[model samples]
Target: MSRLRIHRFAFLGDARPFGDREVIAEPREALEPRVRLGERPTDGLQAERHFAADEIGDGHGQAGIERRRGGRVHGGASISAHARARPGRAQKSAIPDNPRRKRGGIVEVPFRLRFAFAMNLSLYVVTVLIWGTTWIAIKWQLGSVPPPVSIAWRFWLAAAAMFVLLRAMRRPILPPRDAWRFLVAQGFALFCLNFLCFYYSEQVVPSGLVAVVFSTAPLLNSINGRLFMGRPLRQSAIAGALLGLAGIGCLFWQQMAGHVDDRATWIGLAIALAGTMCFSAGNLLSSRMQAMGLHPLATNGWAMLIGATILTAGSIAAGLPLAPDTSPRYLAALVYLAVPGSVIGFTAYLTLVGRIGPERAAYCTVLFPIVALAVSTVFEGYRWSPVAVAGLMLVVAGNLVAFDLTRRFFVRTA
Candidate 1:
């Protein structure tokens, strides 16, 4: 019987044999054999090949020796270990796949979710800015043309623009027959009466004041939602409503005190309040239309056309001159209001209402006033007295309270 010589060697950190005792090798003088006495098949050749590759260029070094100790490679290296081992390659592969890890810590937001959050935020900021600056443009449309005719021309251009856009995009122009009734109602409330009231109100009051009054839409929306949609009116909403009302009273108190006998101020206030209610009603209608599977852009296109038609017919009947304003300023303002204000602003806002419930989305009403007031300060000479500043703060506070953002802020701080 031939005597078998068994050899054992420590593979860096692993204390194990690399080969089986089944294959007996002739004692070679070239390299020392580090073999274990075992019946398992030897992985010595494979280990030698891996070790040679590691020493030459692979750079795994002693780690590769430990990996092949038990006749197979182990895959228990942590992310940090892999990153440290292959800094460049591991960084490229690991961080993006596990978006949870950043700067050596786990953050846990997936790439797609982060992208969607950014998109929603962008839409929100765009909507607020467009609607905010739009009030000043409405002021420019006041002269030469009656509010009805100006409103008519505005929506007609918007409708034409939207229709052309829809055609170019290959989107359907007409809605379902059942949606027509809702569309008509939406046309009347949103595009027709709401704007009519706002334009007339701006004629009597400053456009900024009109915008301030319109800020009450969220409160009205909460009420309408409770009445029509059977949604509960939370205590925060009621508190917000009270604060908003008090702020409005504060805003108008000076005007009322100075000119108690002026009836036009009262009328403007009433009209603005009515317009806000109309806007809130339209919000509910839009929510209903979306629930019925209608896209806001499509519904808005048809509704704007219908509204323009009605306003045009009413302007003709009332004997208001239906001619377009020829002045450069008026024309430019009209185009801006039609395209960005009506088309883009309304679409973005209603889209938000559809995505995040109307109550939360209506916070745009609160934010728009700040932008409007800033523009008013620059263009309309809207001086900010301490009283006006306090009223504005109260309005902002109301928004924070209603949205539960105030509570969230305190919790974060705590």
Candidate 2:
């Protein structure tokens, strides 16, 4: 006869019995022909014995034993098998059902979060490149047309193209009546007044200099967000803003030192700053519209149309030419400004404002100057000075500090 081997399995939280009996039995009775191990007897002795043995070990011990068995335990005797057999008293899962939970001490990012991050990064790159180049394109539009008229034409073409694209996608072109009020306001601030100021500023200043003044947008966005949206004022952001302002002053000082008593330069700086403020306001409006379930492209589409209409009427009343520029370079610039600069660039930027908060989204303004200055060097003969370089560094440093990138890097490394 085979020797009676008692396998004790302990389950930490389980109170169920295991094997045939609760007490140990002598080998003669345990291995009796009537107490067959392979098959159950009609008196239910084998079932009782199996459960009695299982009750001896903790859940961890049972898990260890099951693993040791290479998950090939026979007779439905494993802890998992027991849980399956008795559904009510089954052990709960060790891994959480929450998608964000860590497994084996490693945290996992969900697919949606990764995809969103990628999209935001791509949008940032695209917005920076387009907006940077748009300053030069705006210069091309200045020779033959009034500033407001040029702006009107640019946005009018942009609005028409947006509508055509929307129609192609079978998306609704008209905003809801309730949204029209906000769309009108967005139009004035973003498409109409902002561009008008910027275009006029470009006439008096180098486009790169205008871009430098406009780089104050992140600071303005933060202040506006705190005042209107009730976002908490961060010390880092405030410090960053001050540093950026100082940098701008340094750059301006360099310019003034070179050309003192230039009224147009001062006026251009003031107008560019005002336009930046308007840009920040538009950011907030776009954010609000996004919160209200209005898509950025749709809002921008309607707003551009309203802005174009108003600008067109204003230009007509002001006796500005309503005729389009026929020059190849001017036309090319207009098309580029309408499509990529206004349509694609605004869509990408406002989408970022919705995805990230407006304050963070405005950092793109900080980056825009670098691209603008590079383009200006090639086209407008922009020369970099030591003071200007220092100012740029300070501005870049401020942004890093404001966004907490510096702290995050240290923390991650530590």
- Return the top candidate by TM-score: 2
TM-score for predicted model 1 compared with the true structure: 0.68
lDDT of 2 at 388: 79
Query: Relative to the true structure, how large is the alpha-carbon lDDT of every model?
Result: 0.63, 0.65
Query: Candidate 1, clashing residue pairs?
Result: 7-35, 100-107, 100-108
RMSD for each of the candidates: 21.2, 20.0
lDDT of 1 by residue, 176-219 (tens): 89998988998998899998897787777754466567767767
Models 1 onward score TM values of 0.68, 0.70
lDDT of candidate model 1 versus the reference: 0.63
Model 1: runs farther than 4 Å from truth? 1-116, 206-209, 244-256, 412-414
lDDT for each residue of candidate 2 in 141-192, tens digit (9 for 90 to 100):
7778888888888999999888888888786667778888889999999999
Ten-residue segment with the worst summed lDDT in candidate 1?
Answer: 52-61
